[model samples]
Target chain A: MPAAIETRNLTKQWGDLKAVDKLDLVVNEGECYAFLGRNGSGKSTTARMLLDFIRPTGGSSELLGGSGSDPDIRARVGYLPGDLNLPRTMTGRDAFNYFGGLRPSGESDVRDSLVERFGLDPTRPVRELSTGNRRKVGLILAFMNNPELLILDEPTSGLDPVLQEEFRDLLAERKADGATIWLTSHVMAEVARVADRVGLINEGKLVKELTFEELRHQATTEITFGFAEPVPPSAFEDVTSVAAVTQDGVDLVLSLNGPVGAVLKRAAELDAIRVETEQNDLDTIFIQLLSGEEQS
Target chain B: MSATLSVYRRWIRDRRLSTVSWTLGIVVIIVATAAFYPSLGSTTASIADGSDSGEAMSSLLGLSSGIDPSTPLGYLWISLYANIVPWTLMALGVALGTAAIASDEDTGALEYLLSGPVTRTQVAFARFAAAVSVLLLVSFLSGLSMVLSLPFFDLTESVTTTAPDGSSTTAPGATVGDIATGTFSSFAVALGLTGIAFLIGAATGRKGITLGGASAVGIGGYVLYTLSSMTSSLDFLTWLSPWRWYVDDVMLINGLTWDVTLPFITATLCLLIGWQAFLHRDLQSS
Candidate 1:
């Protein structure tokens, strides 16, 4: 498939600081690539460079096979900045009309649907709207045009959970329509659900890129096995799928790296009471991934 | 419509209320000054006579080429056109120029606007045009207000004065064409400042810096020109000041001159410099 977004050694430098170092990224068409990074880790800077808001000191980027600097290329793209700001006097409706008018596909019907979906008041001046409402306006502006590629930065920062979920649903709907999505969000669950793949960046460097399945694979499953009597932590050590094993009074907790079949077999052989399993969520995984990068 | 037009239209639409407010404010000031010309014309003329040979007062009031401050045109020039109108326009022009890009950039609004289909070039040019349009609008309305107040205030009637030696002098009344000339010259002065402010704002995207830089040009130029009139030491530096030509030409009463084109030329240079800076640099916010 053609790449929807691609960067070749994309770099941006500010005096002594390297905002975005030599980086390579490829997000294929119809793919939802979630760019994950810590705060001030250059995710937003990268996004800004990709959209030509700032020029890279080195290298270049392209969207939909064209330079991002080209207006015609940007016309086929939708973008949402991390902090959405409009003219203070502009109403939500005005933002839609003004921003939407630049592109050919800003159908009023799509705009109306988005406004309703996000539960935004169209008539209030943007200055009066709360951050979440302003974000809704930004989201609507980004999605209203139905562009071929969507570049969103911290897309759900100020949204309530309900609205965040709604936004996820909208992303899903757009993904179903084959629109390429390149987003950077701290909401790990949102990334887990919507992004087919994720790229982790550390201090301006692209550290690792992995499919959601690979990310989950890095997340070990913790299972606890209970026995009538205190159990030693070494019982599941022989099981190839168990990475680590520990004991708590009458239960044994095992961190599994693979299928639970062998651990279950071992647990059944020894357990006289109960069994429980816990999965490491992406939030923990995201932290671990970054902390690991920091360590090295 | 094209992206440039769309951006331009939105800028004008969003500023509609403020635009009306500024225009009305200018109109009220210009008209009120003209209205007072009837009651204060004689006193103002005498004041002009009192300061007639005082070089400092002449420089301050921009009395040039035998302008009698008692005349309708002279009083209007001293009261409104000389300082108030051009100063007000310059202040407003700086504001509009800063608003063109710097104000929006301060709030990250410019970055958001740039992320759309519009090119930075389109935004820079469109916003500069929009700002110029508003400045022109306020200028036209204020001039119209002065013109409308002329007949009501006896500004159309010429006045004659007699000296103790039986010598007499007559100062001509104000005319609609004079008002146009004054307003246009004042606009040109303000436009020059606006272009400077726009250039600074586009180059820096910092409101304080843009306002300060352009304001320095306007106020500093005036001060430099005024001081240079009092001494010969600063005369060489006076050439850099817009007030040098403005007060010397005093287009309000003397009619239009070739010097009027100086401000326009300065404004074009500013636009080109500012545009090049904006086109090449990274935005302040993003």
Candidate 2:
């Protein structure tokens, strides 16, 4: 079977600036792919191109083995834009019903259930809702349809902590049910927890693609050791890829990237005791990739 | 099957306030005119004299000296083409037609409707039809007001007298046939103005600009017609103005003729072009 969503060298340029440049994205079936990028890094532009909201200047995209513009493809795809601007005068229920009515075999009860679960008041006009509630309304509309493919841009930008957790669980449930999800987010922890594979994007280009296990393995490890006596430089000469080393009296804190067993073995030779190691989080990896310090 | 109709229904629901306001404004104007008709008739009769030159007087009133000011039908004729019907129709048409498309898009209601399975042409045609229906209804109400007030002025009574040329007077009573003719002329003028307003709305995608452009075209045409009548050298310019086809003197005195049909036909062509513009243009809800 083909990938759920595929784009081949998709390039979109506005005047002199390239919003999306030669992006090669492959979202597998039932896999939650997280796209990480900074502002003006072409995340939203890529999502817009995927939905055919704006045509790409060059290259092409396909949805479920069909053209992006095909009605069949659109019917199975649910999109939530970065900036959600709905009609202010309509009630939340009315807004959902309006969008739901566009599709065939739409379920009104599903919208109702989602609205209630989010604690959204259907009677209130959208204009009266706070920014977070407004975002909730947009989220409910995008997810309630149970679309075969979901593209959510900054899906948790305005939610409270509890609601954010609920949203993550909802996404987990959807993924378990075999729904392909393409999520773009700046929060590394959120992506680290949910994404099966993460792609780091910067300056409108995809820089790296890593699975969760590979990402964990490639992350830096922090090591701290208290020596029985002062350590000499020759004792640490065999260890390679030491990011930073600091000595406060007899205690040494070394940040390194390599086999943890080798670092421990080398520390034993120095008569160091009380060794501790912790892995670095995705934020460090992301920063390293963005600063051009990571190996390709 | 009923989904398209639901879209139209929602459009009408969205515009209910504006529709009611325009309808009330037109009705109030018609009622005020009906109330003041007696005073107008008496004033015109007192001023009517054989010594007044028909050419100079026609420039101001667009009426020939052949019309007897004592009769209500003659007054109705003057009012129909001179100022009352055209201005009323023009105002109603601009308000209704411009609000039809531009306001929907402005409020984001058009996006909701367009996202449905229905095609763009259906929405355009349905909206145009709805706006035209409102315009025609306003015309019918204005005509009804005039018809209802005909009896209070003793306009239904027949009176025979001699003209200035020593000929027997045959015209009498505010007849239904005469009222129907006036109504048809009003309908044509209203339709023409509405079609022009729709074209402006589709082209501009803005309410204020559409209404302003449509009103300018309408009032500017009337001014052009006046200028054409005064100077024989600029007579060809009259053909460009839709108002020239529904000139007060021509409709009220000459009755409904093929000449008036020209404006209706031109207006239909304009509406067709407007529909095409609406079909091709990309919709952006502001």
- Give the root-mean-square deviation of each candidate in angstroms: 2.3, 5.8
Q: DockQ, per-model, please?
A: 0.77, 0.17
Highest-scoring model, DockQ? 1
Please give the RMSD of candidate 2 to the true structure: 5.8
The alpha-carbon deviation from the true structure for residue A64 of candidate 1, after best TM-score superposition, in angstroms, is 0.9
Indicate the docking level reached by candidate 2.
Answer: incorrect
Docking class of 1: medium
Alpha carbon lDDT at B71, candidate 2: 63
Task: Give all TM-scores, in the order shown.
Answer: 0.94, 0.74
lDDT of 1 by residue, B138-227 (tens): 999999999989999999999898889999988788899999999999999999999999999989989999989999989999999888
Give the per-residue lDDT digits (tens) of candidate 1, residues A154-246: 998999999989999999999999999999976577778899999999899999899999998788788888899987877767889888887
Q: Candidate 2: misplaced stretches above 4 Å? A: A7-29, A33-59, A67-73, A81-89, A96-98, A127-129, A151-159, A183-241, A244-296, B44-116, B137-216, B219-223, B226-238, B248-285
Off by over 4 Å in 1: A224-242, A245-254, A259-276, B50-54, B64-66
- Ten-residue segment with the worst summed lDDT in candidate 2 chain A? A80-89
What is the two-chain DockQ of model 2? 0.17
